[model samples]
Target: MFNNSIPTFKFLSYRRLQAGSLCPMGCNEDEYLHHISNSCSKIKDVFGHLNNWGFAIISCHSFADRCSWLEKKSSFIINLFCSTIYLSWKNRCEMVFGKTGKSPLSITTEAIGIASSLVICNHQNSGQLVVNQQDLLYKSWHPPPPDWIKFNVDASLLCSYKGGVGGVCHDHRGRLLLAFGRSCVHWDIAHLELLAIKTINEVFKDWMLEYNGIIIEGDNINIIKLIHKKIKAGMEGMEYLSFTKNFNHVICNWVNRDSNKLADLCANYAILSSFD
Candidate 1:
């Protein structure tokens, strides 16, 4: 990108891959790397929010200026900058190909997630863990298949069995559609995880008509296995059946804790916020 090698619409048109130099994002302007970094409102919104996230990013008006600005930044910042740029371009391609394009907010979240995962991989390679690294890795959450809506759920418990259960629903593009967290007075971790899975329908009941496939992912492999093995033949079975009946496909999968961080964050937040 710094070498201006990215095949923007202008370049593609020059190479006869496109009909004209108009922006693929429909901004009605010639597409250029510089335009993406400087004038594109969508990418601009992403950077604006990223600055609020404490990256302290600066605005550079030209591709050369961007390169110069990145030269003085820390490696982490440079990686984040490059990641954001790449994601912005990917979103553009999705739109151009008639796929649902991500909003600026979703793009910003994805950039941060990618950067966070890279940072985690770096730390793991260095044989050191950052404080609360598990929490920081929540940004690594993955999206489901293009036709699915995924619910990631988790449970956090204290010694007294007082804790919280939380879950979040995201569409295939990783846009959060619904999030739910609830404080519980007394529940073991296993039951709590089960409850989190069981309540997914209640949280997403209204949106059932809007989505076709349902995927429930959690970090507790044992609990996930239990769910797959057998559901209780009572209210629990009915609830599960009703939710499944609404979707063409219902999938339950176990993810590693790192990939389930957002749900963990939500659960922990629920426990912490209950006292307030």
Candidate 2:
């Protein structure tokens, strides 16, 4: 992208490919790397939120201009900026090439989440003790209480908006009892996360009878809150709450994405395998 070699519609049209130069975002402007990454009205809110988070993104004319502007920023800022750009472009592709339409708010929220994970990882890799409560929460996975089973569930969403849910059940000793992953259809990550919990409920119906007390862990705090009754779960989310009736005692908790790596891998495998 920095070298201005990305195959934007303007570039493809200029090269005599059967493509239109007008922006796919309906901006009536040429579709180019810089325009898509910045200055597009459809994505203005995304950069606006980043600026509010102290990650200032300056609109530039060319890819080289963007590179020059980023040269003065810190490594962390550059990494986050690059990630946001990539996500914005990928979201655009999902709209133009796939059957997904994600809102700018969702994209901005996802970008911020990715940026937070980068911050946490950087602190850990630098051998610096993360003193922030949020950072500490993302440090590692904790084992369940004595005699209680723990289930870690996660949902993965591809750029095409294809999704998958996966989860694993482990005893108090951290011994894995069951693991499952399956492809799902959802345009929103939040819905997919809820689907993941529902899948765990269905998959472990028999285990719920055996294990009286269980804890469910997922990285999406909002979904955890929904399950806790702290937030509204609409009619659809209400359906996922059926697990509470099956288990004698169940705890749905939020864990760090880093700690949920195995579940994430399972989810990703489910989505990727469907393409094969």
Candidate 3:
């Protein structure tokens, strides 16, 4: 319904509903995504609330620009923005259908509630509404938790001792805070991978006096699922997982390799270092 292609009354051009394209606010412009979202006299106040809250993308010139800008923000904040737009759209529909109307303030309040619910429900990994930017669709990585530092770690195993381990730590905005890489002897692949986690954990441990805690990520889901086990099958990782208590808190998560690309690149750098 948010896209321009929809046959809103204004776009349909049927003479009986000739007034359809015209905004009820009498903006004299065809009702489009831009009109309902950031313009139009009926529901523009929601944008003000969103902007004051530092969404940093409402000022963008177009729907596509705003979508790309929102890509860099946290999921909670993005849902907050989405809620505002949705509420505004609903209000517009109600008004047009001659139903009792809701003020923009009411809509904004509801949108904020929606955002709060998203956070409370832990919808951090919920799939996003895919919007096309121009002719193409694009998706990007997500940020870490609010006020928490994150570490992405990976290791490249080789039969040769040229095995490498590395990690990149970043803040909630995905800005690089620290990165480290080194050459290491190739043991079993799982053993070497656990060493990479240990190395990154050590980095966070050293910063224990500065930050509150850290969230560590890797692409190995099987081992991550087994990391907290007391059994011997998890021996390679359980040793390092037990070290979490040394910090304020430590969260271990498995990410797709795409999200872990920066750390994978760091690991490759270590492999090259072995030859140097």
Candidate 4:
């Protein structure tokens, strides 16, 4: 009854059956969902506090049963269930492999954050910006335009004798918002591109404004591909994978080096000015 795309679920089910007998905190197929959701005494303290926020941990005999339960619930309830399930799974992984045991409050807080983000993302994707009636009212009071404002970013690496990286971001009106340069002990174009993306993310966080969308422009085609394409195994792709995962909320694009002149100039200035 399972789909092939969710191979992990199949693996988990097989592992559960082999263990034989389910104890809330021990290996058992019967305990697969229950132990993680409600029966685990280790996380009971955390679950206790979630009731006030209208979160309840329910038990189901199988994944199918869980799906049925979700189908009958309201959207808010469904979101809460998904959030708790994700956090519980995360906690289980951390306990077994990560060797880090977090407090219940921490887990609850994380679950809430994940739930909120999921709701926001789903709404955004459906072209429905408002989560509730209140959100609609709030937007009505201060309406943002339907069109998205785009920002283009680029990083340049100069390799003649001295090694350094330059990064700049500009608004739609061609106004420079961020520009900087830094010396690199080793001249690596890929590394510089990653550094520039990281810097841009930091700047966006500090801006404290909700943007409808963002488009990151870079000259490095490989870096763009790395961010957009799926990575194979090994450390060669890990940094780029991590960076893309971390900033997937923002859209990224690739542009010709010649088309990104203003940002290039800004980066060049930052590097040259640092020496003087």
Candidate 5:
């Protein structure tokens, strides 16, 4: 009965091996399931949220070990893990092979949908278990602010190893309000972040738009933390010090990779612009 109960075990095992063998984010030789699932920066954007939801992640040496642990859980929990594993693998594929990386939120939404269908099927076969309301609610809807704006920025170093910053600002309706990319002599990621912030200040300085709240979104969480006072020492601190000295307005908190999609697109545009 248990053997037929969870098809996800097999699916997860197969996918994990496939992903591990050709792990595209340039995982080091020491990287394994635990490293990829827990520590890798490339994937942290996806799995980091699980910690907030009270999911205990155990590092296992073998697929069988991971599956054995998963099978002992409630169907809801089992399905959640399965969905996450599947989606993480999917996102890796999109990022490496397709060059079309999606945000963690979008990937999570898809994972839940896929897992819910599987769970429903399993429940129906096993005499219809009661569905958890919280799970259903989480799956059914996502509430984004009505009038918030998101700005995405990316920086790429050109010929002299000097970088260029690109950014795009978009409203809640996904309308592009401003898009610009500029070349800079900045040499490192930290300097690039500072450049992005400086460019944003220039935009606001010119437009003088009276916004109730604003979100400066970027894929670089280190820069975000530096801006938000979460961390004290780092490249972000230097950038923050510079930004505070120049700009007076308070920028809202930093967001994850998933929430900063528009910024990535703008960054890519900025890179492309350098060639022209």
Candidate 6:
């Protein structure tokens, strides 16, 4: 999956590519975050709301400069900034993947809603207000068994039926082995979660990963229980049978959504992405 020939990595040295200084969008110019946020005909609309929020979207010379500005902002404003950027990224993915025609205004609305919810949650957790103990959950990601790599997955629907799923694999010491997010047009979460597992399994296989075990974790208790039973009974479906047959140490477990935050974040990322 590591394509060294192009700028596949997020921090890739992209200037050396064959396309050189031209965007794939045919702008005949380098595709930097500045161009993406301001000049790209495909995604310029995605940043329109930034002007309404008093942010000079095109003023930042680089992504790091924007980060520096965001770092000085309040939580509410930071949420808005980060969420808008994330939504814009997702829209870019959609355009690249040829799933276009979505309205920028609608996406802006969703980004605002998500940012407001995050602000509210931050306020509740900030301890300035009394949050009910019964309603508050402080679940944190836990390490897997000593030698296992845990894969946590989550899926959510946004913008009415567009789905995204994401998963991450971390070793016992919390070292990330892999992470992926994918977007789909359907809102069938049950299907999406399972698809995430299958994709993860394939990646592990392709990488020829050396691990004592692979633990699949997610928030769906029923699916967790079912997978566990299938593995135990040696009756795992075709989707997972290859995994069970190849690896003697595989596990399926349920985690609270809070504990699976990384995976959930991946899923959120996926909903706006077009790739694994």
Best by lDDT: 1
**On residues 1-276, what C-alpha lDDT tens digit does candidate 6 reach at each position?**
112232321224353434344555667667665555546664566566445433345556665676677677666556665666567667666666788745665565455546644544554468554232212222455567777777888887775888887777766655455667778877677887777666665556444346677778889877677677776776745565476555657777888888777577667766766433
Query: lDDT: which is higher, 1 or 6?
Result: 1
On residues 151-253, what C-alpha lDDT tens digit does candidate 1 reach at each position?
8899999987788888777776655666667888675689888877876756656655678788888999999888777643433544544676677777888
Query: On TM-score, who's better, 4 or 6?
Result: 6
Candidate 4 segments whose C-alpha is farther than 4 A from its true place: 1-30, 42-44, 56-65, 125-276
- Local accuracy by lDDT, each model: 0.74, 0.71, 0.63, 0.51, 0.53, 0.62
Better of 1 and 3 by TM-score: 1
| Candidate 6: clashing pairs of residues | 164-271
> What's the residue-level lDDT of 261 in candidate 1?
76
Clash statistics: count for each candidate: 0, 0, 2, 1, 2, 1
Judged by TM-score relative to the true structure, which candidate is superior, 2 or 6? 6
Query: Which segments of candidate 2 are over 4 A away from where they belong?
Result: 129-276
Which clashing pairs does model 1 show? none
Q: How does residue 81 of candidate 5 score in lDDT? A: 68
lDDT score of model 1? 0.74
Cα lDDT tens digits, model 2, 79-182, are 66777777888888888886586666456645644655566556657977555433332357655766778888899997788888887766655445666778
Task: Give candidate 1's error at residue 72 in angstroms.
Answer: 2.3
Q: Can you rank all candidates by lDDT, best first? A: 1, 2, 3, 6, 5, 4
lDDT of 4 by residue, 1-276 (tens): 224222133345575633333433454334444455555564566566456334565656656776787787756456666676567666766665657766665566555545544554555569766444223212322111232233444555566634445554434333234444555444676776666655554444435244444566667888877766543333354443343343324565777766565345445544544211
On a 0 to 100 scale, what is the lDDT of residue 217 in model 1?
89
State the TM-score for model 1.
Answer: 0.51
Question: What is the Cα-based lDDT of residue 141 in candidate 2?
Answer: 62
How far off is model 5, as Cα RMSD? 14.8
